[model samples]
Target chain A: MELLDFARGPALQFALAVFVLGFLWRIVSLFLMPRTKDRSAARPGTRPALFAATREIIRRTAPDKAFGKHSLFALVNGYVFHVGLFIVIIGFAPHIVFFRDLLGVAWPSLPNNVIYAAGVITIASMMVALVRRFLNPVQRLISTLDDYFSWLVTFLPVLTGLLANSHLWVRYETLLAIHILSVELFLIWLPFGKLMHLALVFVTRSQIGTHLAHRGAQI
Target chain B: MTREINVQAAANRFLAQISGNLGAYMEACLHCGHCADACHFYAVTDDPRYTPAYKLFPMARTYKRSKPPLSWFGGAPKVTEKDLQEWEELLFDSCTMCGRCTMVCPMGIDIASIVAASRQAFVAAGLGPPDLLQAAENARDKGSPLGVSADVLADRVEWLADDNEVDIPLDKEKADVLLTVSSIELMKYPDSLVAMAKLLNHAGIDWTLSSKGYEATNFGFLSGRSDIAKIMIQRIVDAAESVGAKTVVIPECGHAYGVLRWAGANILGKPLPFEVVHITEFLADLKRRGKLKLKPMGDAVTYHDPCQISRRGGATQAARDLLDGFATDFREMTPTGNHNWCCGGGGGVQAMSRAAGLRHKVFKLKMDQVEQTGADTMLSACANCRLTMDESKEHWHWDKDLGSLVEVLAEHIDESNAAA
Candidate 1:
């Protein structure tokens, strides 16, 4: 088979299977872990624990006032890259075509320029983030090899996809093939590395949210 | 490595108790460094190692190795003796387990809880602070970390009653309220215990001081020994049960409220039969119910939230409501309530004599917090907080008056309506 066909077919299939199974395995392991019971007398909260957990997922998108000033760069930069990736992935017409062909469904795509702008912004934001990690003393100290590797895999697909669309790379087919391969790499890495935070962040936020809300503090 | 204890066994023991959100929190961390600034130690010292997430290294490292799939990669770093040596200070001396980092993290990792878990592993490895460990031993053996025994509490109560001319009941067979004082109150601040008596008497509540479990403070909880925490809390539980007390009013001790109200049942693997409340919460309820007629004061006052009481304990408004009830000019610290900065001396840090310099150093930030509030009197519902802040105040020679909330509130209880 041609490289493009192999990249878009067997590689995609294998990566998805690994991603799905690994993701589920990791989640199951989390559930398997014993949970600390709050056997203390509880105060009635205005909202139920479940609702509070759901609320905290959105509430923590911004930092609390005391620490907000310090988190400004992280806040804006994080949102920019994440929203940018979402737009580039699902809001672009070609990406939507790939999605519809896979899932048998598609949403409305943004204009080409908008998608291009999002792609550029995502790339820039990611680079700035990586630089921040490289430079900031705290980030530099805490970041592990997994953090840098995850960033590379995540950034490659966006960069390759944008180059393929712009036809600025070696050839359209090769660029698209490389883009698909990069996405596969990201999928394989997602369930194992810190990128697994995609699923676990909600789990963590919800768990703590419930724990605190049950005790009468608003998350 | 310590020769007497097997380090790997301690790691295994700690890994065995990985409960609740431990797995998820370990998986969710991005090492984004957001938790760094959220920590008071890092906030004050600007030290990268003092970052909250870094403190979880030992536990996180061991946890990865304990799990098969993650360890199979051969990439999970081994915990070194050298790493443990540095972490001993990082986990015990610096971080207060205040939960501010937990609150501020975008991923919702319980950074403070995980830090406490790391301390458990260290303590198991025979690496805990000697001061805190000794205090826990005293708490387990003597019924009070400060060695304030039952006879000491009874004699002190008697002396305070005669000195203040107040009705102080002790060891009643049955009472609706069981007033438990911290060792700090019994050993050092007997007047606060007197204040407790005055408030309970003014409310006409059926309250009694149990000689069996008078010390509310639990050093075992601070030292990361859940077994000792259970034993310490069980004394109070048994005392409450024997006395037939419906409510155990935890004195102005933050960690006491934590280990008793929150961790009591979890450590014991059973729910406590009676209610556990902080003195501030009980006082606030009394104020709400018009049980105590407190005369309003004009002095400018603010409250220092003990980490365990306000943020981790979730009784954010109890002290504020009590203060607002009686103070006409009650000022607030920036980021008050659950978001308030931890007084530098919590989480057994105050008990560890070696941590005094760092404790006093970071206390400058807390002093700045109080000074900015422009308050003459800063009251704390947690004696652990008041004790440390008072010491730090002496170090800095800070001019403001620091008082326990219940003690200050005692002065405001209207004498005309007080029960004879």
Candidate 2:
């Protein structure tokens, strides 16, 4: 568990604490921010309406099933990248060791080869999304430097991790340290980036649910 | 039925007709597809060509490539002769100018405005629209969008009085509320008129329907004819002013609500002397004040978000407020409020028969929403949306009742004399 040792150097500790505090602040803002009053009248007693509204929110926000409606390669490849990357993030053996020691909990880690493969796929998919954003006029119009930079920020960890894990570039210790640090940085940025929708989903869903309950509709 | 004008000349005329509006607002588009799915026609048809983006591209490219920095790139996505021909149908026939597209657009491009401009472009090019739009244009020029002349307007109001045994105050000078309605309410949606009358009576509100500025629904909003939109709205503002009505109330038509609430003041060159309240907003106010009472239906009721009244009219919460209090079970359509999908009507597409099939297809979003809800009845606040839902119900055989919020509330209005 020596590698499970804390990168407790003041630099890493400071970065980690700032990341944790900043992430919580973003989540809090989403919860406390007031949206314009929904045009619907508020009726607190309508249980059925609230349930229906809740159910509708869940149904609508559920992931799109008609991947064909989106570009097939984009949708399938994007999902593979996201899902795979998520697995590698938590399922890599070293990550599990760190989590178990630090958080006092751990899930079974994926085999080393699988984690490396997922990282590669994730990097490829990130490139595709970036290229598409640049090439498409509509996407080009809407995108800003911040958006492109965010993608690179996200893709960097996975690309670095794969190189580090496979020993293709640098020593394993150096690459692992960089990967862990970059990940901490990403964690800090998530709530601030467009990724903050994760916090918003709950609020929106609950609002719609409470609203429908007032209308006496079940979800 | 009106005779169709020559398509080529109509397209050219359409361009001339919208030159004024084009000069002002045509440069506002940034081509975000947020407006694309917001359009009922696009939703129903599932046609990318009908998207506000694609529909406006030919014209935008034409102006861009020929006019400025964009012309250096050969006008980014150069428009072809075929694109021009294809766009006539996309702009004129497919769009309803509902302003639903405009409401959802983040940049607020006013795609409906652009569609209106494109329709004018088509008209100028000798690509006249179908019989219904042409008739509406002719009617607008003559007096009403429905071709209801001054004499017919008077007769219709009188017929309403005789038919319902309620006297509609005509041209009353300085009433507290100048209640206005679109032409459809006069021509076919008598039930809406009856509901307004009953509500006004129940609330004991001082209101009068204007005989002079009778038609509140402006076809100019549809055809992208600013002169017509201005003239049509001015007539209502003038009538309301002449009558000294403190507030102007718009009924359940989406475009009419947008005209008065969103664009009315601008058209008049000042804030309207009176506040323009949509019927839903008015009804919500009455309920809030305990002026109107609803007997709970205690049945499964789903709500449809009319593009104009909910999103455009700034009263998305009002309709829900009314429906929530009255229905035993009220379900919301997916993507409700400003994010709600169109009912495949709006703009002037409801009148153009050639676009009906495409319009119906664009309504698939609503149809899918309705299906998901599994509610037996759906309520809407716009006549066109209600009508479009009814048509979708029949076409899809959804076995659901489509109705206006007022109509539903009006039905449940406990007219018990014993309580009084």
| DockQ values of all predictions | 0.73, 0.03
Q: lDDT tens digits, residues A68-164, model 1?
A: 4566797789989999998898898988898899899988999999999999999999999999998989989988888899999999999999899
Q: What TM-score does each of the candidates earn?
A: 0.97, 0.64
Q: lDDT by residue for model 2 over B1-420, one digit each (tens)?
A: 433445444434434434322422343443334454455665554555666666776566455444322244354564555666667777777766655554333233446656666666655554546564565576567677677776777787788878888767777666899988766777777778878888777777888877668777787767656667788888887888888888788888887877666666656566667777788888898889888877888878788777666554456788878877688788876766766777776776677767667766766677678778878777887887776667766777666677777878878887563122
Q: What is the TM-score of chain B alone in each candidate?
A: 0.97, 0.85
lDDT tens readout by residue for model 1, B300-362: 988888888888888888988887758899999887888888888889998989888888888
- True interface contacts reproduced by each model, as a fraction? 0.73, 0.01
Best candidate (score: DockQ)? 1
Candidate 1, pairs of clashing residues: A35-B20, A36-B20, B252-B383
Query: Candidate 1 versus the native: TM-score?
Result: 0.97
Candidate 2 chain B, run of 10 with poorest lDDT: B17-26
